[model samples]
Target: MKHLSGKLFISITAYCAISFSSQELAAQSDVLDINEIGNVDISTLLEDTKTFNTIGMGIALSIAECHGKDICEPTVDEGEIGQLIETLDQRIEGVVSRQQNSEEELTPIITAYVDTKEKYADYLERLSEISKPEPELPQEEFVEEDLFTDEDALTEDEYSAFDDFEEDLEDDEDLDEFEDEYDLE
Candidate 1:
């Protein structure tokens, strides 16, 4: 009967421990600020993750070292823990506020940049229209000036050569007559 009572007590204690641990985990998870952490840059995110991991490991080691000692007592000072949590909350809020301010400050500069870009594009379009080449109309047919007037005379030898060339042309017969005489057809 005593052994059975011991087993029952151990079982109840184990159940209570499990329930308490689960509740603690749930409470810790509720306090996590997803939005505050999400806004952090990649470099800072990595650094913070590394720092937190180191701190968590140190705490875990401290707890392990205190095993079987009075230092491993389950009792916690709620006032001190609450103060630390509040300080951390304030820091997170400050970071979030700073991020919001930076975004607000940049808004006008971004607007001005966009406006300047649009105006530059409009100016370029106007310049292109003004600089465009005009279409060419059909040019007038060129009328060459008379290089030699009637006052210019041909020499006698030049005239005779011209007459001889004309007479030779008139004396030449058609190719059909020449072919008929030769019986080439």
Candidate 2:
């Protein structure tokens, strides 16, 4: 009787221990982990277009990788910097449109855009210090040929042909037969 009671107690204890550990693990999974949060400070990087694209960012990455620590900014010219920002702005707007304006999706893209803009801005400021005015090359004399002179240029007859072609395209007998594919008003 004493041995049986001891075995029963041990079995109960073991089950309870297993249950507690599993419950603890489940609880931990439900909580947010601080380490997994995106906390990388990108404020120092300029939010410009050049750093936004893969190629431009690749050049920037090479510099960063070569440097042991984070540097303050890039050293690109002011015009180049502005171009970069404009390009980045266009890209961000396009992405936002495609995502249908969802805040969750826009958040990371916006952050990256801003960071690139800031980095390029910094690079522009630095460039102003030792930058020289680029020497202007002699302008080439304009030798113009009219676009209308091109062999593919549409003539009055060609334009009329397009109308005929469009009429032919609209004359699809199959479209009317497939009315069941759509509901009529």
1-185: candidate 1 lDDT, tens digit per residue: 99668645644554454355435434543443444543445454334333333322332332333334432322222232343344345434544455576653333323332343343344334333332234466554445367567767688998999999987776665566788899987
- Which residue pairs of candidate 1 clash? none
Looking at model 2, report the run of 10 residues with the lowest lDDT sum. Answer: 32-41
lDDT of 1 at 150: 71
- Candidate 2 stretches with Cα past 4 Å from truth are 1-76, 98-104, 131-185
**Full-model lDDT for every candidate:** 0.44, 0.48
Q: For candidate 2, give the lDDT of residue 157.
A: 93
RMSD of each: 34.7, 28.2
TM-score between candidate 2 and the true structure: 0.32
- Indicate which candidate wins on lDDT: 2
Q: How would you encode candidate 2's per-residue C-alpha lDDT over 1-185 as one tens digit per residue?
A: 99668645644553454345335433432331223112222231222222243333432432333233333232233565576567556555655554573433455656676676677666455454442545566555344466356687888998999999888777765566566567541
Off by over 4 Å in 1: 1-42, 70-87, 99-185
